[model samples]
Target: MTIQNSHNTLPLDPAQPERQARDEGQGPMPPQAPTPTQPLAQPTPQAQVVPQPIAYQPQPAAAPSNGVALTAMILGIVGAVAGFWAVVPITGYFSAAFGFPLAVAAVICGHIGRARSKRVGGVGRIQALVGFLLGYVSIAVMVIASAAWTVFLFIGSL
Candidate 1:
C-alpha cells in the first residue's frame, strides 16, 4: 500500500454542511456575487420631500399678583377715607376713632409685604410703599385733628 500524507486534507465539499470551516476570527461573511443568469439591482432616483414648519401661536404670559401687597393697599385706602369723619368735633371722635388702629395695621401689612417682596418675587413693592404712605398720612391727620380739637375745647372753656 502506498503511503499518503496525513497533512494533505481533502478539499471541502459545498454540499456537506458539517465539513465547512468555522471562519475563525475573520470579520463578516463576504456578500455573494451575482450569477451570470441573475441581474444586478438598480437604485432609482425619486422625489426629495422638504419638511414644512408648523405654525405654533403661544398666548401672552400674565403678571403675577401679590395678595399681601393688594390687601395692605386696600386697607390703607379704606382707613384713610373712613378717617375723614374722625377729624370732626364731637361724635366723630367716638365711632370713627377705630380707623387709627386700621391705619396701624396697614402700616404693619405694608412692612410685611415689603419683606416678602425682597424674599420672593411677584410681591408689589410700589403697592406696599403706597400703603405705607397712606397709613402715615392717615395717622398724622388723626393726631393733628385730635390735638386741634382738644386745644379748641381748652380755649372754649377759658
Candidate 2:
C-alpha cells in the first residue's frame, strides 16, 4: 500500500523495492525481480465524492407600515374640526353634510390602522386608538347638533 502526501507518494513498507521504484517515477520492476519473501502490492480502491444538499433557513417577515395610522390620525383631526364648525348657524348645514362623511371615513381608516398596528407588535397602536376616539367623538357631536337643529325647526314650524 502507498500513501499520497501532497506531490510525494510514500510506500507503507520501505523494504519493497518495486513500490520505491514506482513512487520515484520508474515503472514497476520485472516480475522475476520480485523476491519470494516480499509480497506484491494490491491496487487501492478509488474514493467517490458525494455532494450534500444545502439546509433551508426560514426568513423573518417584514414589519408593517405606519402610514395608515398617520392617515387615520390626520383624517380624524380634520373630521373633528369640521364637526365643531358644524354648530354654526348658516355654514353648519354644509359642515354637517361634509363632516359626517369624513368622520365615517376616519372611523374606517382608524379601524384598519389599529388592526395593522396589532399585527406589527404595537407599532402606531396609540395613534390608531386616538384616531378611533376622535372619529367617534366627531360623529357624536355632528349627530347631536343635527338632531337639535331638526327639533328646533320642527317646534318652530308647529
Candidate 3:
C-alpha cells in the first residue's frame, strides 16, 4: 500500500486560477445613484406643558392618647413623688420594691415612646428620656435607703 501524507489538505476550488484571471480582466463595478425621495419637514416646537400646582392638604397630627411617652411621664412622676416616703426604713423598703418595678416600666415605656415618636416624626423624645431617668433615680434612692436600714438593723442586733 502507498503511504499518504495526513497533514495535506485539498483546496475548495480547483479552478481558482481561472476565476482570478476573469476578476482581474473586469474592473470594479461603479456605485449606483441614489433614488429621489420625498424631503422630511422639521417638526414644530411643541407647546410647553406647564404642570398645574396640586392643592396642599395638611395631614392631621397624631393624638397624644395611647402614647407610651405620656404613660412613662405619668409613672415617673408618681415614682418620684413616692420616693419622698423612702425616708422611713419601712416605707423605703416598700417603696424600693414598688419603685424598682415602676422604674423598669417607665424605661420600657420611654423606649417604646421614643421609637414611636421617631416613626411618626413627633417631638417628645426629651420628655421620655427625662421621665425614664427620673424613675430610675427614684428607684435607686429607695433601694439605697432600704439597704442602709437593713445594715443599721444588723449592726444593732450585733
Candidate 4:
C-alpha cells in the first residue's frame, strides 16, 4: 500500500493504514460485514451513568487532648500529700521544702489548664479547678507548719 501527501509525493508504510486513509481524506473504516461462518454479534447498549447528588455527611468533632489538666490534677494530688506530712515537727521542714515547689507547679499548671479548657471547651475544667484548690491548700498547710516550727525553735533556743 502507498499513501500520497497532498503537499508532497512520499510513500508511507503499509503498517500505518489508518494514517494512510486519513491522509487520503477518508474517515475511520466501517464495521466489517460478518461472514456466514461467523455470526454477527449485536452491540449491547451500555447503561448511561447518571451522577447522583452526594449526601452531606458531617463528621463528628474529635475530642481535644487535655494532658495539661491531667498533669495539674496529678501534681496537685502529690503536692497535697506531701503538704499533709508538714504536720510533723522537724521532718515537716523537709516535707514543706519538697512540697512547696510541687504545690507551685500544680497551681501554675492548674491555671494554664483551666484557661485552655475555657478556650478549647470545658473538658478538663473540673480537674484544673481541683488542682488549683489542692495546690493552695497544700501551700497553706506548709506555711502554717513552717511558722509553728520557727516559733517552737526560737523559744527553745532562747
Best by lDDT: 4
Model 3 Cα RMSD, Å?
15.2
Off by over 4 Å in 4: 1-61
Question: 48-114, model 4: which lDDT tens digit per residue?
Answer: 9999999999999888877788888999999999998998987899999999999999999999999
**What's the best-to-worst order under lDDT?**
4, 2, 1, 3
Model 4: residue 141 alpha-carbon error in angstroms: 0.6
Cα RMSD of all models vs. native, in order, equals: 17.0, 16.2, 15.2, 11.5
Q: What is the TM-score of each candidate against the true structure?
A: 0.55, 0.58, 0.55, 0.61
* Residue 34 displacement in candidate 1 (angstroms): 69
Clashes of each: 0, 0, 0, 0
Candidate 3 lDDT over 9-80, as tens digits, reads 444554443454467886444433332464556689999999999999999986654368878887787887
lDDT of 3 at 48: 94
Model 2, runs deviating above 4 Å: 1-64
Give Cα distance to truth, residue 3, candidate 1, Å: 99
Q: Please, what are the lDDT tens digits per residue for candidate 2 over residues 1-158?
A: 77888898766774566767787989887665456687877878888888999899889878667778888888889899999887886677788788888888888888999999988888888888888788999999988888888888889999
| lDDT, model 3, position 109 | 83
Clashing pairs in 4: none
